[model samples]
Target: MLTLLILISVGLASAHHSGEHFEGEKVFRVSIQDEKQVHLMHVLANQVEVDFWKPDSVSQIRPESKTDFRVKAHQVDEVEHFLEEKGLTHEVLIHDLNKLVTNQFDSLIRSSGHSYEKYNSWEKIEAWTGQIAAENPKLVSRSVIGTTFEGRSLYLLKVGKAGSNKPAIFIDCGFHAREWISPAFCQWFVREAVRTYGTEIQITNILDKLDFYVLPVFNIDGYVYSWTKSRMWRKTRSTISGTSCVGTDPNRNFDAGWCEIGASSSPCAETYCGPTVESEKETKALVNFIRKNLNSIKAYVTIHSYSQLLLFPYSKNYALTKDHVELNNLAKAMVKELEALYNTKYTYGPGATTIYPAAGGSDDWAYDQGIKYSFTFELRDTGRYGFLLPESQIRPTCEETVLAIKYLSNYVLEHLY
Candidate 1:
């Protein structure tokens, strides 16, 4: 069954060609500090793209006013003007529809000689994982931690040498669904892990001494929706029970300072925090798994895309953590290592200070759980491509990311007590 999915995905990807068109709709990326503000702002706008920074539906505000709002901006300058005039108080960037390109590294990988037999649907990724585990049983094992709202299996891959007690690193991707680069990075991480295990000293050392838990796709239902119905779906597909609104931002549903400053309470708002903390099954599953493994999990690393940032925790506000200095230093070192490969610049800083205040994020949750080395990597295109990053950049982005991860992992291994 998984094999069939891969074949279908490969065929679809290979048949894909560029120059296809969207509505040429004007899109503006807006940031609102409060959850209510996100709701009110979205309610007032004409046509807005929340960019998965916020949740959808399932909010703290009344559902009656939740709606499709659009910012008045057809061009970048106009967007700037709108931002200046509105005093919106959140970061708003206006962009046109000319940026999405399909010719990227993942696309190339799908169309390349890697066997259409191996490149199928989202299910097939698990099949590939199974095959890898079967062959390298000592270093790879598959675990079904929980199930998604849609009942899809949440598969986790624990990769490392055969051992009982070892410091571990936790990595997850595709929490936002639209950030396709996240899953691509997870796949790339697996590929690199397999290829460089015995070759690279640092990688080999880390793998031999520590375990890596990789969750390739966190929001499976939403990810499938992005591939099929809407390429921009940002939350899970679970219905909000009484309302017609669907999905909640899983990232915003965590219990860590949830729905306070950076999240929303309106069901129609993009950053909707959900009915309550850990309302989404997927979020609960991840939270429980991390909590169970909190002691040995030395670091938590999540991959997101199109921001070109290496951000550390405390995203809910601007308050600095005790390890801020060490985290910042490591981010700088990782950026230096990443830049050596592709010359792509990555802004490294505390999350709230670097981007905006985002409450209840997985990184912050992990940090609160005592995992100090928690980081989120937002990869590629400061705005050149947005969420529709072309496939051509996958290899370079993943390659540089691998360097950064390896550097960080080595640092963890050396300092581990």
Candidate 2:
């Protein structure tokens, strides 16, 4: 039995090592000098296996914008030569991605137990949700909303004082599997809510007036795949019929402007929109829950990373939302509060104009469902580390983000009428 256990351990280690195919891969920060260069880059992306680290997809790239993309080691020379041929100026943001991946987990070994300063795996986070809820019965509670494609329980924590039919703000993280920091912030937010229930004035006031529905990780299957199979995996883990692609982009599986823009129809594409609207089980579950509680949920906040943007509705088109003035002012105020801590700046505006026209996003869908204060937060270090943000920065990132969320929650509370 001991020998069998040793063999299993070796096999697991080998599997993990095999997944680190990004060794020596370089992330290039390319500056789009003109509109033509954006088109050229899109063409280049089609001809190669380059992964867009910022702006998400090639369609979002624009003139005068700085785009970050990752290219495998073998294609580095070819990509560099192609960029030179196109006369585009670019610099290497990450010289070796594997080195950063290695450094990201170095602090984990020094800790005696689970530490919020370091990124925790899905299993750790799953266990944490129950433990936190059990420990703080009055201010927190946990419930499984649904199950993932891989059969993992999707846990949602309710953080607030026990009350009847209180207005609530819905916040979710880890929509993309590889965005470890996203889930980290969700966990930190819950911890902050529970830890500061009575001690902190803003948080206490917000909790007294509102309930926070926090989904720590949305893409459970893909999140697990990222931990065990590939560190850079995005999308869900459900297999589509007639194709080998494993997952759909949950953010693009919503009903609002489904698959219309900034999304891909190809199953193999990173931004694959899925076979149909709400095709993925995870998205369907979220939609059902939100639709069931549409009356009480006033705001919808979905968190993402590596862009440092706070965006509002109308992501499917350039048309302004009816609540444009109110949403914009709220975003600006929240961003100002975020910036006050550590001087970290955040860009705030409508999703379509502020970033790109991404169809089927949760915030846009929620707004369409009459949840007026819908917002999406792209957190931390525009593109310095991209999805591989170091563990050292998690605390500060969550801290500043908490301030922004508090500002928004307080605003939502005042205007809950």
Candidate 3:
């Protein structure tokens, strides 16, 4: 009985990670013969079977039928053409799969070698935030907006000079959980802010005028799980109420497009949206905090990895915003600044045209919530070093990113207040 109980518990735990288990080589589609079966797929040279993030009531996917997906035969370009010609709305291929995986491995090795004096673990991110706040009492302060699913404190480190309430810039990282570089960049930004305040008049001036509130790692439970088990793990670890699947992609869990268009309703998927909107505690905390600070926040930026593209809102659909032109120009300028620093290039454009149509993304949410300068940065090498970006590239990546942020910051300063 004891052994059987243990087995059941383990099976239940594994269900969250188990979606419609597909070997990386197989291309299969979930068909909704009677209903629309739309799920988000991250296109590469090949379409690997990653579970789509689904909402609560309809989390379990009872696939009406299976369709073979010949990803390799149809190259990413071919796939894009196919989707276009078919008038099918979905995430078409952008980068090749081999290059993406290879670059990810390379990045991991490279990052492992770099030595950042003040780097901290998932558990220590807040402690480090506290230390930095204490050290720079006048310019920095920390707030615990709320706790993550597993009760880890979600901290917002606000950086700026003492005085009047300034127009704020909100930046969040580690939203996908496995993108260590995102969180790393957040820490690096804070460190640089502390080091350059007095010397770099430009940075100092911006800090004096604007406040930067950064959430280093938004998905703490998933991040901790990635560190412990799977390096490629995405989404949170909150268990769904029925049918055993756990975790919802916090990114997809946002209420903006909830589970429409680019998201799936399968509990076993990678981009699984939890039981409901703001289902994940972390996302709820973020939403609550953002609602409170909405009036002050002028620009909102969320950092992610691999594609080296700077994208703007309407990720849920292709509809252009009123400020599309200005956003595009700003993105172009930011990428130019990034390239000027390290000769590294980045594509910049609207989210749907730039990459894929993603629903419920924080950037789109921020934009919808009236933050005009909402942007999402897909950082680092386009493919030579995807998610597994190395320690060695950390400095260069952070440096280039800093340049882009500075560019945007300068632009925000001129526009906001």
Candidate 4:
């Protein structure tokens, strides 16, 4: 299967064309010491073409938080000058966005096809869905849950032994296009599932009784655009009517809060919730699948990256869920297991309090739909690397993540009543 994954990489190289170059663009991190600092950055964002790399929006930036953003080469001087003038403490995290992006490739030759260590193109990942299922017939099978606006298949892989009426966990990744590490972890997970099914006792038992529905890439069109046009692109690649703006943030496209807060109404905004709930085909597809499988899906895991956070429900607001204690305990246990592997620290709690309030998020939607174990994983490197985590670290990131996910799954299995 690994060999087939490598072979799949060879043919899809041309699908990704030379994208927008980030040559002198730099990523900056600002230390927000007070509401004054937060307000200052928020005001600056509106004045400049600043892109928030971490918080997703200026509204989410809070006092005492460190925000990461990318400023274009032409605007860096002005942005820095403004920061200095305002007395906001800040530093360059990525000196050269282009160099960091280039280093992320880790190889110029591109000999291999689909690799767990390397970020794979959508074309390669799409093909691997079919190939990996064929290679491991007993443990894996692929089906199309839906298609993107661009008509790419929304490949869903069911990973586990065939069973009569088993409960399952729904796991998805790549909701935002430029978060390449998100999809990388999904592929690594499926690979580990089939590779260690019988040899690894924990995975063995988990697969014996529970099925895992894995969507390797949820935002297909935008992921392709990120590879072929813009490396920092985030959102679905659907064209909104009456505007030239391209896409909606799928994370904010769910029905949980339906863009009530921590989301944008403007079509061009990064966190645009779409015209309405489940408006995007990808959002509809996932909603329909989970709805159809609601009876058996005991847990929901939506993977994302660069924050190393394990978050639970109520992302739409600050109110705690009824299962707050139970969920918090589980999250704490999961973090413990994850950190044990590499000593990679992970903070865990309710989403709104832990990070920022993000309405229409899939985890919140899933939890509201009765999947009590719904969780979101923001994986790896707090922001030393951000979305462009090096290929060399993929293995450890995935390895540690698997520990947390497996722990969560075990908890679900034990509590499924």
Measured by TM-score, the strongest candidate is 4
| TM-score for each model | 0.81, 0.94, 0.76, 0.95
Pairs with steric clashes in candidate 4: 9-113
Which window of 10 residues has the lowest lDDT sum in candidate 2? 105-114
lDDT of all the models against the reference? 0.74, 0.88, 0.72, 0.90
Across 78-171, the per-residue lDDT of candidate 3 in tens digits comes to: 5556456544444423234333332332222212222242223576676678888999998899999999878888989999997676899999
Ordered list by TM-score, greatest first: 4, 2, 1, 3
Q: What is the lDDT of residue 213 in candidate 4?
A: 99
Number of backbone-clashing residue pairs for each candidate, in the order shown: 33, 0, 21, 1
Model 4, 11-55: lDDT tens per residue? 333234474678789999999999889899978998899899889
- Order of all candidates by lDDT, from best down to worst? 4, 2, 1, 3
In angstroms, give how far residue 375 of model 1 lies from its true place. Answer: 0.5
Better of 3 and 4 by TM-score: 4
Residue 15 of model 4, lDDT score: 33
- Segments of candidate 2 deviating more than 4 angstroms: 1-19, 106-109
- How many Å off is the CA of 91 in candidate 3? 20
**Evaluation by lDDT, superior candidate among 2 and 4:** 4
Where model 3 places Cα greater than 4 Å from the true spot, the runs are: 1-120
